[model samples]
Target: MPLPNGYSINAASSDESEDAERLIETVSVPPQCCSARLNLAVLMFFGFSVVYGLRVNLSVAMVAMVNNTDPKPWENHSVVPAACPRSSGAENTSDTFQQPDGVPQYPWDSETQGWLLGAFFFGYLCTQIPGGYLSGHYGGKLFLGLGVLGTAALTVLTPLAARMGSYWLFALRALEGFGEGVTYPAMMAMWARWAPPLERSRLMTLSGSGGNFGAFLALPLTGYICQALGWPAVFYLFGGAGCLWAVFWFSLVSDDPRTHPRISKEEKDYIINAIGPQGTGHGWSVPVLSMLLSVPLWAIIVTQMCANWSYYTLLTSLPSYMNNILHFDLQSNGFLSALPYLGAWLVSTLSGVVADKLIEKKVLSVTNVRKLFTLIGQILPAVFLVLVSYSGCSHILTVTFLTLSTTIGGTSASGVFINQIDIAPRYAGFLLGITNTFGTIPGIVAPIATGYFTEDNTLAGWRKVFWVSAGIGVCGAIVFTIFGSGELQPWAVTEEERAETDKRRSGSISQ
Candidate 1:
């Protein structure tokens, strides 16, 4: 792709001073492996993994942490025809989660537990906009490292906070939410500099998939920790790892690739040529009002919000459902709950590949493929959740339904999830901050709503929960299908942006 006679890809002005002209060089080729960018992607993958591990550990440990009343209250009100015999996990109670004699268990009600589980998102919402702007303007590394460090430190204190009372737990978790909220936006900012045009999707997906992987591994492992050591150990071990990772991040990472000490000159030059000047922070600012008026932006927001409602419902509530309604022991509950995330993690990677292939083949417009996959992601998950509702006492059927719901929902990663960058690459990080803010709403509301609905852990209550989630998913898909667009919005261009575009266009033509 290098131009004839070694012309610079940036198409700089001919009137440049001697020094500026000397700095311009022909486009260099990217390294395939052992390159600085790939190293960043790998470390970032683990960064997301550790952060997400910190996020989901509560869902599984909450099973062992709460002391439920022995059966009498909901037995009569629970779902009928319980055809599947009770699992030994429910009946054997010889000692579930190892129930270490001295371990403390809270007498929290379902609604309160819901409140506790959803507490993280309370702080998550408040930080997104400011985090996006700060990370974009200053550099993502410091914020990203600090965010994880704060969350990890708070996580280690979670047991103490909970023991202090429900209010204390809420305040502490809200702070953790505040810390972790910067994660996605901060990473997006990093990618704006680290990712070349051709490598953007690959690098981003590689790093982002860590969330799914973290949930998959952490759940079963947390179950074992709760069983073998104690619930407190779950928090201690994961939080400790998170703290260590933050230190490692600061030691190894740089905000811009051009400034990295260990990066090869060839790779640095290649990355520079491949990624043009992007973002507006120095003298310009985002057009917030125009974004508010954008239909496509709203569609992404609405779809993200609705889709995440179902996701958080499963994330926060699924373990409770397995434990109380399905009567799974702590160990079984964690493994079963984690299964869906494992399926989701695998499918998420594949769906992006499928999306890219379809686009490469020219089988559909970028917009059409996005809508198509989004519909597949949303509608099918709704159907599966509906099935999960009717699965009755059949553990096999319920697990299958749950797994299918999450596995198929993975397609959304290739859909509206990445559409923000397509619509406005320059503002991609900020837009993600906006979308994730609304998306975090589900994480807050779904758990509380689920707790409110399933007070007695009755079959009928869980049914209603699934039905509501299904309905929301359907509505989100419908809105996105009708209003989503892949093309960049006209308002994305300002005078400075327009000039940058003209330069790039002229460069392409010159080639």
Candidate 2:
């Protein structure tokens, strides 16, 4: 057989050559032909489903755990050792005292609580680059499973930490964030492997929607668990669920379509051909400089930052908002706060499918389709934020605006998440990590900022936070419109590099 551009035939034994040829023949799936690919995608999506479910459960549990009074009066009034003075190290002095109004404050005070909320992002932000690297080096299945397991273990420990004291709780949450951080990149890597070109948007959107589902389920489930069995039970339930998911994931998933024993050859070929030649390489190093310089990449990052500011704010603070501002009881707060996430779940599912349909029919260019969703997602929410800010204690209007804002943001999963795949399948994970790192800055900032803003429970302070959120949303929309494109740049890979990749793949197959 003639050698392709950048490779030559190996001088191996006939047996080796025959095995390579047979494997290649078996794996040469036609586009959209493989049932195994779909099965794998579904399994992977479920893995993400449970991972997110457990991860977000903390948001709901926090409402009960942080505010609960210790039954043992001695435990409540335990004196600090001289070596552990309230102001020592990073500890907040205020956490040691009950509030003047007799409210049960977090043991670590307002500043310490801010740190606890923000600390998770410190580990989360730090892990993105490394997680992407690991996903590339080790493949998605192993890293993703291990990440879930790690997250599960940490989650199980959270209740124990709370029982022990505040410092341990902060430490455990940060560790959980580190483990959970790997999930998105791994999911992106899986999409690059399993999804056909036509189905990329829909599949990615559906997979990403699992997070919304998790958020939606977490509130009511954790609330009930807290109410019935105490806040500790919430962590125990989510943690146990995560571990079960990891067991199934390890049993079922493989990183490559070819390696999956259950996948048909036709489907494997289809997936590979649809993804094209550039998808073959899997290495820790990515074209970091090229991604950094790309205007579209920066646009995606900025949009993610804006989108996540609202997302994290709601995730971390909405329960408190519902309790304090709306005056809902715990059960009511849990059920109501979950509504926006449910709305987002529905919106994401529909938008993803619709975006794919638009792409399939050629009715809208991929760029236009992405832009349409991104525009509606950000702009509408900004409008709603303004309304939410000015509603002035009208509980009904405030909830309505909040719901609209979150539901609109769901359109981002269709736009930015899928667009990352469109721009570069090979580096999709890395690009997502970079964008996510940028996005998480707000995750780190928003909770603390909210604490500062709402210190006095005044409407004016709350209004300022919403206005800032609105302004950020508007800025993201403008940037995305100006710079976002679906087209992959030539500089992302050279002609020589492409030829070299094709050569290697063809040579390996023909051996």
Candidate 3:
């Protein structure tokens, strides 16, 4: 009754070679010095960091990207005339890139800026489902790496695109979005294969936090780059870094432990056994109708949409908000704009550890844990968002509230984001893709809507935008708390999978 490679399993009478090979993969910690899974998490963390780095650099650069000499096009559409003072030379710096007096300027307004920010999501929206399917069926290694590489290549072309015209710049940004759209779903598929249930929150959030980290770095870094090397250098530097990352990504990582060359045998055995049956195969259908009708799935979709509404709004608009409302200069605006995401990254990192411990110790049911954290992520941000609106010109108070909102919302990393895996580990990729499709809608809509409201860049208009965000947050929290769940559905298993289960059970009994 010796196990394969000295591996032991609680279940007896398993003679299948695949089972033997797999059981060898899952276990308690091996005698190895380090876990390969940890390495994968680290790579994935930095991978997502690179994705957001390329994505958000434009937002920071936008402050210095265009001329403010003429009245913004949306000024006529204003709720009230924008009384905010434009940045003077002392704050803006006499960088040749800004070249406000001497250089040619694009004829864009707040509305046009919103369109540019939102255009990425238009192309981003098109590829989610296909990306999920491709990553799951084919392996995420190629999809994830190529996706980042494509985005990096496009990013370097952004300055040239901007020089062409507004429409051209928009098109280029959309193309970049198309490349990046695959990232989350591919990462989800890969994590489905790698993450143990107990360790799920920790690993997934560690990777997810990279997005916040990217935002954290990009705002300040891009601002400084724009100040020194000019706006184009921001694109060149981040894009080049992304290209280098792609080279390292291809060399360093694989989709799963089974394929990773450097992983230890004991660690491989531990992963396979701990992960249980991965009910995936070629020609698998995604159970589309069931997913559409599922309450928990819809809850995730709605909540994510709400979250992204606030997140994308802030990501795209925060610099302008600071610049206009509180009168922070470009460098100060970038520094202040990045602060909230730093809080977000910190919260996400801490909450991941706390969530895993709660589930591991059985202090809360998985369903309840998701609901609790989702509520925290939702309601706290709603409250703080409203507080931010009212705080008005009080710089310290406004920043603190914005930071709290982002930090609390970061709990969703462990909550709704990882809940898909709890309920549908086999199909987590597709599930995330579906939810993210809804989630990305906010990315498309929020900036545009905020722009329309804040066209005059007046405090009254900005207040309206925050109010709308808070309302959506409340509705999402309510719906998700009532309908969300973490239990696997029966339909998650195919007929073949059920038969395999029965056969394994019968074999164990007959022994």
Candidate 4:
């Protein structure tokens, strides 16, 4: 019988399977081959590194910004603004506020700072669905390049915003957030297109490690820039770097191996053959009913949310925390705050390589390997966070435990990110966007909660925040263990979907 799409439905003949195997063998890089793929991986890594470096620069700058200002206290003896003489010392006091020529300054209020920090995620949270859809329809290259360009433009504008005022600063930050919202989904879609099944875990991990590296670089580098040239320079330097990357990206990258002029025909065949049946065609909308009803997807979303809570809390609050609680100078605080991310970058790269090797060796089933790493990622970090919280004021113990926590947390790239590819290679970007949208909700809430919880620098307050993070981590680990799986469910496409796919195929053939 003819297949529904006019292809033969019969099982592949031994001859056909043999032909496919021979083609793959002829085109495939040897087991140790890493040249072309490694080059592509490095390019992608630096792309994400630039994106995240710009994103995190603001956090480091906030440390210096806060320190340079004088604190105000409310007192009954203090004269009101209305009661003070027009030329009184209170009116002319330079210590009360420092308004540099091109730097943005705002009242030194914790709540306002929290709002500035959390506001980016608001735009980030809103754009994932649209970004994923665009990446699916137009291919990742277009949206990915656009995302880079948009963010770079916004980054350049940030310095101007600071010079303009606090309101402008917030507006520019929101725009930057919106532009960056496109990045992950676009990159995820690119992975679906470019990565071989065997190499998916490793490549995704490497891509993710770039973000950690960005965090590592941004803290100290931006801090030094802010210190030397003032905070506005941080935006100008990173923003310029991002713009330069966009130029390189548009010239070098393509959505499919088939279209890339630099990719050899042999490599194209290898990539296409490696991906097998599911890699063709533009992605369709997820079957919302099925995904919503799936207990597994819900569990994954919950686990992602839990993971992000800890991650964003550190990203948003760490520089300030080191300066305040650890009593480090601005330069020292920047260096110390970066240590965790340095550890994270190492752990992320290593875990991905190890996970892929285990799969290649057949030492663990795909599902079990992913689960093993997921548990390690969540549970070990949870334990370390608790330890870090209780380490008293000992700087050495504090840094050690925080480093351990970040290193362990880096394994999520192996577990959660790679599992998206495993479960839905065809729709990996959309599925990831769905879960990431939920995960980023905590990005909004966490910084605000950190602001409120640590308002007084009391030990109890900080302890409470750590406890909540640990509890969330435990719950995420439990949910992932119970429901996360590496296997894809059989497609339950409706008749309409099948028809649409068939029509598209026919149209391609007629062309």
List of clashing residue pairs for candidate 4 = none
Tens digits of per-residue lDDT, candidate 2, 158-258, equal 76677677888778878877887887887777777677666777677777787788778888887777666767777788888888888888887878776
Ranked by lDDT, the better of candidates 1 and 4 is: 1
Q: Which ten-residue region of model 3 has the weakest summed lDDT?
A: 5-14
Q: lDDT for each of the candidates?
A: 0.79, 0.70, 0.79, 0.72
Q: What lDDT score is found at residue 211 in candidate 3? A: 95
Output candidate 4 Cα RMSD.
8.3
Encode model 4's per-residue lDDT on 343-437: one tens digit a residue: 88988899989987776666676677788898999999999889878976667888898888988889877886567666666666777778888
lDDT of 4 at 198: 66
- Give the C-alpha miss distance for residue 495 in model 1, angstroms: 3.9
- Residue-level lDDT tens digits of model 1 in 403-439: 9999889888778887876566657778889989998
TM-score each candidate.
0.88, 0.83, 0.89, 0.85
